[model samples]
Target: MRFVLKHPEQADVEKIESLDSVKGTFTQAGQFQVIIGNDVDLFYNDFADVSGIEGTSKETVKDLAKSNQNALQRLMSNLAEIFSPLIPALITGGLILGFRNILEGVQIQMLGQKIVDGALAFTQNGAPIYNTIVDVSQFWSGVNHFLWLIGEAIFHFLPVGITWSITRKMGTTQILGIVLGITLVSPQLMNAYGVAGAESINTWNFGFAEVQMIGYQAQVLPAMMAGFVLVYLERFFKKVIPNAVSMVFVPLLSIIPAVLVAHVILGPIGWTIGAWISDVVYAGLTSQLRVLFAAIFGFFYSPLVITGLHHMTNAIDLQLTADFGGTLLWPMIAFSNIAQGSAVLGIYLLHRGDKKEEQVSIPAIISAYLGVTEPAMFGINMKYRYPFIAAMIGSSIAAVVSVGLGLMANSIGVGGLPGFLSFNADRWLLFGLIALIAMVVPATLTYMYGKRVEGNE
Candidate 1:
């Protein structure tokens, strides 16, 4: 970690240099720079004691944390507001998708297995028992197909739902956004997905510009963008047009321009951007740099949580699944979360004799293992210092190992124990083993550190 100190005094320079964790310090005139190679927390706490350093006071730290939260909240507020209404549908779709994947995995796993082979000799050439298992398999197979349809129905037309949601969020006419969204993905229009791939499809020139007609099924950014356009244009028309004719003219104007712009411009732009991110991430995951990629993300993930930047990974995970049928990052996040929980467990073990400490640590462990790390992180690991660092190390190791083992998740949600539902079933065992390692390594390291610090505390 590096930070600049403006107008630093001689005493301030001396104080920072005294900290052993400060790897390097440089100064030119009144400007000072310090690099902490390890123990960023120590630097933050110690440097705050310096006269000119801004964030060392308790109130400053609290305010800084709040400021970070507000910044992140504002960054995501609009998108989150739009998505909040669709959460139920998203949850339902994800659960069904997970169930379908699991059922398919079970069928594949049982393909070569023999069930009650001797029972077949006793009952009508074993047809009864064989038919029973076959029937069950077929039953699940049918159920999985239905579940797939249920999930796909929501996922395929997500653009429309999101558009409707956005319009509501923006306080605009929902009907116009809905119509724009439907027109974007309409089957009657040229297929948006396949248009670029096919050579036979021709572009339409509207005198102003030539645009290839395409649909927007399974898209999100375009729908949200069109909502923005509709909201602004609707407001404009409502302001300028007479109320007698405004209702019809506003909807008509909003629908036409919004759909046109989304289809002709924003839709393709968003698709290209999403596709580029997927390709870049895929390349990093597939290449030799993958281990480094996983380690960096895994190690820094906890810090991202503090700043609320972790939410951004959700989009990346979804895009990865869309392009590659699975996501490499979700497993890394799982390992990181598990590591934080294990670190809290370590802190708990160290304070075995103290009921108050144990009480705090116990729930933290549970919360972290449940894929919510805030309790474990702020409650125990961050407080202990060494445990947080140990957790980062453990998570980084596990992430690199996971990448090596080719562990991946089919979707992003239900991490920790329920993470199995998101995992690629073929490598479930491998994912579990890596997660276990992530837990054990951090717990052991933090426990050892805690033992040494126990009496001192």
Candidate 2:
């Protein structure tokens, strides 16, 4: 008997293998293969296939089970494992960033116009630079300010959202976690970004110690770790606290101290780490060695996405944009995304004669181009290695050109065609040229020389 179990647990595999009749075992795409000389009974349900007798005809069922059971679990277990939980927040944040980019562009255009007008007046009137400007409010009207605020709010409270997601994953009380998260990013707390200058002056006396009330707005690591720590605290409290008073004391004691510790310690430490990374990435990528830097990043960025380490780049991107006028590294990411999608499209072209292969490649191609590369990466490119290499070459070329042209986005997160909205208006044409190159190069190379394989199914 040869059977494939759809959702294979280690326990189930062990049990099947323990049987005297079992001869061999293998696993792939969420399937566990058990080969025996004769029919053997297995406790587990959802047999994907038994000697090519499929469980169902639906691809969705197969794909969903495969992704949940195989890809993520087989990868790294720490930060990478949490990428699944973080997906909703990531997609939402990326979409909302488009609005932020638009508002930023409007502000830049208005400020540039005002400065030019002020300069002309100054030249004629012989006034100082400071005295030349008539009104600062004219640069950003009330509506613009409100729209900008709306755009910033999502990113500003991202820590809260991440904390909420993490706590849910860790089996902590969602409301308590939310409360702790919100308190960390509260409007009452001093902004973390502004804390450096205020470190000398800002002080709060809490009887036990005098500490600064720094907020954790936009912090990623601290929020995620804090949520994980809350689980143990809640579990400890459940054992000690009296049932009648447990509700009030457990929540108060568990969250208040955690929040305080996070604010005083974790928040600042995460901020420093984020800042250091931003400095390194920005300085390194913008240096005279930029062409080499671009090529290296473009080559490795897609692989980083596969391991789920790309989330680390978000902090660097956010901080770099805040410190510099705009971000220079994000264009490399966009180019890499375009290249990955183009390679998938090339695979689709090569396999057009096979309906099954085309079916697999088309959706993966669409997803890659839309700035979500996992489908294409895991589903198609990883299966046939040469397409991935072709994509890296394309990404490298595009990244070098982008860096040479000094292309940048006002914000991070957006990529692919949607990324055009995030480009600096002055460099829009250069951005387009780079994206086009990224797309065409990989497609051409993959079609000409990259290895092609039939559908994995």
Q: Give, for candidate 1, the lowest lDDT window spanning 10 residues.
A: 126-135
List lDDT for all candidates, in order.
0.72, 0.68
Show model 2 residue runs off by greater than 4 Å.
1-143, 196-200, 242-244, 319-326, 450-457
lDDT of 2 by residue, 31-138 (tens): 444444224434223243444444443334444434555445433333443444655554455445445444444333333344454353343567523211223554
Could you tell me how far off, in angstroms, the CA of residue 214 lies in candidate 1 after the best superposition?
2.5
TM-scores, one per candidate: 0.73, 0.73
User: Residue 423 of model 2: what lDDT?
Assistant: 61
Q: In candidate 1, what are the lDDT values of residues 1-457, reduced to their tens digit?
A: 3333322343465575556554335431122335453366776676677746555453333333333234545466455557757756765666676667666654332344334644332345643322222335788768877777877667667788888887887788887778777887787767655765787765678898788767766666667677788789889889999999987798887778877788778888888887898889888877999989888888898887665567667667766776677788888888899999999888887778865566557877888887888667765676668999999999999989988777877766665656776664556788778888988999999999888777577
Query: Which run of 10 residues does model 2 get worst, by summed lDDT?
Result: 128-137
The residue-level lDDT of candidate 1 at 245 comes to 95
Candidate 1 CA-lDDT value = 0.72
Give stretches of model 1 more than 4 Å off.
Answer: 1-73, 80-88, 105-136, 174-176, 190-199, 202-210, 238-247
